[model samples]
Target: MSSPGFKADAAAMTRAVQGFEECAANAKKTMSDLENDLVSALSHYQGSQATAFWQLHTQLQDKMRVASSELDTMSNLVNQSFHNYGSGDSTVAQSLTSLSNNVDAGGAVFGRLTGA
Candidate 1:
């Protein structure tokens, strides 16, 4: 039977990871900018209404941070998977090559002994 094979578009995977990382970075930057703007706009405000608004905003920001973190983690995982697959594929190929070489040498020795 033929050896199993693996094929992947490494360039596409790379681009996907890059895109995820960029999105994460953008999310973080946007959150920071939003926070700055909110603080500036609310600086002159006061009262329980403002406090409630800030609390809600904080919760929203926390969720956004989580999302951004998740994106970054996803990107890292994809990149890691790509590398691992590549390494595993190379190892399998080398093992197959070595096994084939050994079989060839054995066959040659057998032929010599049998005068074939």
Candidate 2:
């Protein structure tokens, strides 16, 4: 028999993954806001310092964009995984069912052998 807690555990894990995605989204948005603020700051400068500052900010911005994209990818994957989790029809569920069936069959065979 499947543990009654299996569903609860799955639900907990689903919540955790959603929390991960939420935190990532918050980080992405905060980084984007920071990028915008830096861009505004970049516009009010002049000469050599401005050029140097622009180069640094541009490099940081590119890296931030990549980080945001990665977080988006993480959210997609986690959502897919948790969708499967909630269905009670994931690969893990199937495998558990198969194992239970096998165990039952083995017990029946053993019972016959023992004349029970």
* Cα lDDT, all candidates: 0.76, 0.84
Q: Which prediction has the highest lDDT against the true structure?
A: 2
C-alpha lDDT of candidate 1 relative to the true structure? 0.76
TM-score for each model: 0.70, 0.69
Residue 90 shift from truth in candidate 1, angstroms: 1.7
Give the worst 10-residue stretch by lDDT in candidate 2.
84-93
Tens digits of lDDT, candidate 2, 5-98 = 8777787877889799789978988998998899899989889989999999989988998998898898888888787666654666789889
- Cα deviation at 80, candidate 1, in Å, is 0.8
Give model 1's TM-score versus the native structure: 0.70
User: Cα deviation of 28 in candidate 2 (Å)?
Assistant: 1.3
